[model samples]
Structure formats: structure tokens, C-alpha cells
Target: MDIIKGVPLTSYILLCSILFAIGALGVLYRRNALVIFMCIELMLNAVNLLMVAFSRYFNDSNAQVFVFFIMAVAAAEVSVGLAILMMVYRNTKTTDIDALSKLKY
Candidate 1:
């Protein structure tokens, strides 16, 4: 806690912003579904980091609780998302986003 408090708020904000930007760019530019999914997780992690930083700075436990909820939800999402991705790959033989776009029967 002390280590986190030692760092300035601006530093955390800047780090989160950079992480979010990278995740956003990866989501937008990557063609593979897995890569896009990873980017989405990265974005979520950035938000979580910001939340935890603010909670630590403010000496509040609410944001920390919310972060746990977010992490649990993310875990469930990963299971479901990976199942869907596996099904898509099994059907289309490719994980390309463009390939999925052409999957209309």
C-alpha cells in the first residue's frame, strides 16, 4: 500500500491511459478473434488498475470490492468467450474477423 501511495496519481493515470490506448488499437487493428479478445482483457485490466489506484489514493474500499467483481465477471467471460471461439474455429477453420463476417448461412 505504501508503495502504491508513494507513486503520484498522474503516473497511474498515464500508465492506465497508455495501456488502454494499446488495447484499443489492438482491438481495432487485429484480425484474429483471440487477439481481439486479449485486447479487450487488456482494456479491462487498464480500467481495473485505475480503479485500484483511485481506491488506494482515496483510502476507500468500495473500488477494491468493485474490482473483485470485475475480475470475477472477466473470468466468466473468458470461459464463455473461449468456448465460442473454439466453436467458431471448429466451424470456419480460421479465427480471422473477416472470415467470421462471411459466415452467414
Candidate 2:
């Protein structure tokens, strides 16, 4: 009753690629800072998924450990990123990235 054996590695890779691409597009097309941040998280998760998939396929714990580190980094990033975004929003009163262009000074 092994689930991983049923799914090919290529399929996993393809799915990861598609997810990563969607995340990238979201970041590029969305003007809202929150949405962009979410997209970045999506991209990181996609990579994590790929890493886990490969790790499992190769029967290696190293990739799993790497995934744990990535998750930790992502958590820290979320906290710091949200804090910064909150401060920016409080000052600018807007979440639109284009509105922040005045900060070039």
C-alpha cells in the first residue's frame, strides 16, 4: 500500500513546476503587497514540495532536513515581512505597491 510508488517522479516535478510558475505570475501581476507576499510563500512551498518528493524518491533524509530549514526560514520571513508590511501600510494607508514609489527619496 505505497502511495508514492503509484505516482511517477516526472508527474511530481511537473506539478511543482506548474505551481512555481503560478506563484511567479502571481507575484508579477499582482499589485497588492499582501498578494505578492502570498505568492512568494507559494513559490517557497512549491520548492519544498519538490525537495520532499525527490528526497523520498531517493530514500534520503538530507533533503527532508533541508525542507525543515526552509520551513523555519519561511516562518521567520512571514513574521518579519508582515511586520514590515504592517508598518508600510500604517504609514502609506495603502497596500498597492505602486503607491510606495514615492519612497524613492
Candidate 3:
């Protein structure tokens, strides 16, 4: 909790909120699949940051463990997601969301 002791909870909340909002906005407004994927990772990282912040604030290690698991899942997700995106790009020659309406093989 040493780091938590140095910073206020409110500051952590604000930073995570901003990060999540940016991620959400990018997911909603961005047309590129890769950009949207990165934004989703941003959102996940923001959540992980909040979880660690809360864990430290409350002196509980459970949230930190959960964050670790989440990070592992996110890593797996990125590997699979990037592969799919690459396949889509190869098929369509573009990564635009609108261009991927029908994914029929």
C-alpha cells in the first residue's frame, strides 16, 4: 500500500475514468479495427489500474490477483484478436469497420 499511501483515491478514480472514457469514445467513433482493438485494450488496462488502486487502498490482495488473471486473459485476447484482424485485412485489403459487414467465407 506504499504507492497508494502516496496518492489519493480520488486521483486514481479520475485517471481511470478518463482512460475509460477515451477508450469508450474511441471504440464508438473509430472506424479502424486495429484502433478499436487498441482502445479496448486501453479500457481493460484502465480497469486493471482501478482494480490495483482499490486493492492497495483497501489493503486487499484479491483485486491484485484478479488483475493479474485479467492481464493474462487480455494477452490471450490480443493474440487471437490480432490474428483475426490480420485475416480480415488480408481478405478485404482494408481494416475499416464498414467494409466488414459480411464475413462469409
Model 3: C-alpha RMSD to truth? 2.5
lDDT of each: 0.94, 0.95, 0.93
lDDT per residue (tens digit) for residues 32-85 in model 1: 999999999999999999999999888999999999999999999999999999
Q: Give Cα distance to truth, residue 34, candidate 3, Å.
A: 0.2
Of the two candidates 2 and 3, the one with more favorable lDDT, higher being better, is: 2
- The clash count of every prediction, one per candidate, is 0, 0, 0
By TM-score: ranked, best first = 2, 1, 3
Q: Candidate 2 clash total?
A: 0
Decide which is better by TM-score, 2 or 3.
Answer: 2
Top TM-score prediction, candidate number = 2
Model 2 misplaced regions, further than 4 Å: 103-105
For model 2, residues 53-81, the per-residue Cα lDDT tens digits are 99989999999999999999999999999
Please give me the total number of clashing residue pairs in predicted model 1.
0
Model 2 / residue 20 / CA error / Å:
0.2
lDDT of 1: 0.94
